[model samples]
Target: MSKRVLLPEDPRWMPFCKRYAGNIERFAIEVVGITPSYQQMELFGSVSPSRSRTSVASGHGTGKTAGIAVIVLWHQLCYPMSVTLLTANDMDQLKATVWKEIGISHERIRRGRHGWIAEHLEILADASCRIKGFEAIWFTESKTANEKTANKMAGRHGEWLLVIADEASTLPDAVLTTLSGALTEQHNRMLLTSQFTRNAGFFYRTQNELSIENGGEWNNLRFSSFDSPFVSDSSLKELWDQYDDDERNVRLLGISPQDSSKHMMNRKVAEAMYRRGRIIKDNENYGWLVLVDIASGEGLRDKSACILARVIGYGDMGPDARRVEMVKVPLLTNKIRSNTFAGYVSDNGAELSNVTYVIDSGGLGINVCQDLEDMNKVVHRVNWGNPCFKNINKDRYLNLRAQAMHQAARAAKDGRLSILTGDYRNQMLDQSARIPKTFTDKGRIRVPPKGATEWDGMGSPDLWDAVCFAFLEDVSYIVSGEIGMGGLVNSAADTALKRTEEMFSDV
Candidate 1:
């Protein structure tokens, strides 16, 4: 058997050398696959690259981590004696995953004296690269670490440094601020990667602000799993097929999906009923309503919004009532403006008489209720206290809402929920599944991924707000002897009243 002896110029040596090129070259060859396309090469080679920052927005399995690894090696080798920092949302993650990959790649490169890789054609003698966990790097709790690290990294005068942030979306704004600060007083490069989301976090804001100015300091690169040469076409198709509409949009399409848990009414159910012309009832009194959730002011961490609706109500249905419907005005920001919100309430059925406005007085909803009261509208502040008590039988309310959502999901699965087949309902359904369940300290439920706090997406707690208000209205009428109860009245009324009150209470 003849063994193939590889020479310096041989393609076999190419991978080793390419894997260790300076930050830009390594990314082009190892990660991106083709030599930096003309634009990429020139962009990186420029003395002062207009965009010192670049974001590779790609789908899962697109070798994002691998691409990042190559960039780290490149930075270390390209600028001898320079410092490059690699960090993520969590430090353990940096060491466990990213650093492990870098270590393996670095080891493969034939070592030369003074920390240089001869086979990879890169040198890292005087340069020191450190992988710091985001917690230690950002100082989320203690300012001491963050300030010290920021000052040390930033004060490195006459040194070239590059900072690479992985999973940029998950990092808090404070950490990002610290990282950004490290670039001050020196020539530095920034590379960020994440799936796109609607919240204007530091990453989103930086990308947008820099892009708009055309300031030549930032570049936004977006890619889907299909764009990856490493991902097989067949596998990509299978992934798309397996993911539900929401997951497909968020994970593969780079669009942010709404969080599912926050929704009270399922889009699927709404669509199904709408298709059968059952959305709005005939010869029934319909009215406009408003639903609100208060803000916690954790900044991008968590904010809230309410859902206002122009609902066409169906008066009491018979025991065997088969037909019931309501026309729902969709939730929109512009429509929720103070003037618009007040106008909707004051314009009572367009007759200018006092209209019924239901407001959530839980958390931040208290402020909204006050706003409505000041406006002189007959605002019914529905109090939904914290649904966190151990004895509260929280599952009842959760189950009811879950059942409503599940009914919708099943309807969608059964091809029953295609009513008003446009983008709105579809988008809503897509966002809902992304909402992950979070168990709070007080045993209350919330959504993980934290992004659900924003009302920008369809997953805003708006639907839940609307449903709670509706529940309150029903309970109020029933308690006031205005409505008669049916066979399921005991279970429904008890569950509804308990959950509604618990959810709206200030505590």
Candidate 2:
């Protein structure tokens, strides 16, 4: 193998290379001959050796394409044997915007004082950029990001690798994961830029996870079109007049689209909770409950799901201790017989006497609960189709199911609830996201019957049903009261506290 060449060490280029190795902004303005906007400059500053991961969410007219192209050129010119992989949601996007911008920037440098450096660099007909003699070692290449092209992004090892994911929000998770695998070296860097079109994705996670408010420790930049000097005030006014708040959020505010009014749970919130993946531990500050949402029939199409959930207590002082934590507690099988499930409960109940079993009393649930109760287990049977008891959310829900799901959705939105990672994670996320909501004739919040909704042809959302079942307001044992304080409640105090809890639940 031939020895690697270091471009910055050459006496002729040493001063120029040393000046720009740490400052990509100066390199873009002086070397690449382009003026970067304030937002773009901030992005350049944020991409340090220590923090190689930089995510940029920008509105339209922010010149993100130009910013990305300049960075690609900077990496190729300054670093030795560097490989820059440029990718977007589609091949057409590569040809139209960022790839086109790269060609323009390359020409600018080719005609400038640094024209000698651009002489060795070639933008091939195949859309690959490389130094003339060191074609194998130094280059920038474009690949359409998708499941089919994901493999092309992996195993890209080099001394200095820079992966630029343009329009990253539109790329699939598979492509992002593959691209992430390529950045294994310390010198390797990745830049993700996109309009915040959707809320749940790697791009969204980069922004949300690294936020200062979330106690994140990396660089996450947000740039609005209004902040860009190129976007005229008159054009912004036209955008404001043409679109509503949600539309303008994505187009001008550089923010993710807000949760739509239709879906009961936002996919982004659910994904964040899953990413958090905080496991629940048995403690004095929490009361555990077994929540079950059983399949209605004996068909193999539907499965019953059971979750171990907790109501947090006052003793815990941690920042996130106030939220409920849920785990997908196992059953005998996906399609467990009612008798077999009751047996499993009997086996586990001795170890968790303080925990109560709350089972849905619809279809097969009633029979299962009856069996458990006959076996001398205290079971709370909740009829989801029945009207919710009054004083809950000012009678906003049309039925108990709606009330439970609405509360659970609200808890997820408020960051007051978390679902631990498990074997059924993807299923749980899809199910939660597929929850459909409507208003009753009386304008009460209504979650449609499970049969009314379908996601990716999924039959019933067993896991999400268990989650919603866990959030039933009336059934949640108040951990601050006699029930949790001593794990036992005398009849008189129980009656009084139960009434009080009903009157002021979630207040």
Candidate 3:
């Protein structure tokens, strides 16, 4: 096959090529032969003289790869002797995702009636393509970026240059710096496509620096999975159920996670738990555990809380088998004595017959635990200030409270626990989501003590602490030493121990 350089004098395809040169949407439809989504249409239109830079924060299954391929082909076909360069965080992504899509689109164009345009475009062995006679000057090249190979993106000066950075969020700063330097020419264009996962990065900064609304240089856009023609409702629902809100925003909404690096749990997990809590019917098969967090005094800033959780698979075969279904009806009051609080717990437990009470026995909690004990209730007086249980990861936690909070977070993440819903659900969820996660000097994960945490305008995290107390009790039954991972509450070992104790008492 002879290399044919397309000239203005070439009457066969020159007229068709010149017609769609400025119109990418028409070029994509007529030349490329594919229908573009509304978001993709906007992406094609964003390529103008005024906007040399375009950054798209795209969610999953939104046809971002196709959009990139179209722009590459459009640039190659429309402009004579033009260059398009594509790069990603790594070589595998460059070849596997972006270049793979380019190949698919190229094949599609060839199969269509517009086989002439495809004929001049020759895909090379090195993951690149070139126009038949203009092979040296007109071509698109892909490179995997790292500290060493990042410089390959630099010095790309031409009349029409398009540099695309795929998966831009995680791409190294060195690659961005080098590629950005190439956009010095007037006709040169830069395209960044990613989920924009992190708060601080070159991609994140470009979004701010190139804001069109604020009268910046770049045209920025977001493509959500909800708006994508490629994604199904069932798939979206699965994503909603599996990920927390911050992660959901990144993966489904094409929105960057706000404070995702700091928080313990996001609202999506809390809301999902609440939704599941509504559907799953409660039964009498499981024993209940009453988690109590007592306040110092009955004041505006001080309030005690009690959460009754139905323990499923408590004495189950393994830790993973256990689940905690929290009853939406929680007892919260700013005005209640320790004795009165104990009575309230006793009444709630009386119907269940087999119940265990876990009271936070720091400060005024001791008095409440004693009152519950005096009422002949099975009680575990847990001091939040005490060291975490031996079986729990002591190296990871600063204290029992930190251990409990981390455990509750893990349970929420693993779908092992249900969150509260109703009147106080907002405040409770807020507190749970705002639980401070920090690392100690020993590089172990730790949650700050209640006193050290900032509660903003809200009072003590009593409701959240009460929930943590529930998970704390899940492991508190290890007094006999080294029990297997038979989950919280009604394990076979626990039932056997209780029967033995009762038999000894009867004797």
Candidates in order, TM-scores: namely 0.45, 0.51, 0.57
* lDDT tens digits by residue: candidate 3, 338-385: 767778877776655357888888878887889888888889887777
In terms of lDDT, the poorest run of 10 residues in model 1 is: 135-144
lDDT for each of the candidates?
Answer: 0.45, 0.72, 0.72
Candidate 3 Cα RMSD (Å): 13.5
lDDT of 3 at 339: 62
Stretches of candidate 2 exceeding 4 Å from the true structure: 1-11, 48-51, 210-217, 261-507
Residue 130 C-alpha lDDT in model 3? 91
Write one digit per residue (lDDT tens) for candidate 1, span 1-507.
Answer: 975332333454445445444346544454334444333344344322412667655456666665565566655444434456665545655565566656555654434222223233332322223322221221111111243355554443335666777667555666667666666544577776776543456766655665535564556665566666666889778667544455454467654445553332354544454466434332233343444444444444233334433243221122211122223333423324443444443443233122356665665556666767786766776554434222323422233232233333433443332233232444344444433332221112333433454334433444333433443313221111111122322333455687789999987
Which has the higher TM-score value, candidate number 2 or candidate number 3?
3
| Per-residue lDDT of model 2, residues 301-397, tens digit only | 5888777676663211235324677744565246577657767765654444357788877877788899888977668888877787765343456
The best candidate in terms of lDDT: 3
Question: Which stretches in model 3 have alpha-carbon errors above 4 Å?
Answer: 1-10, 48-51, 263-410, 413-507
Of candidate 3, the 10-residue stretch with the lowest lDDT total is 477-486
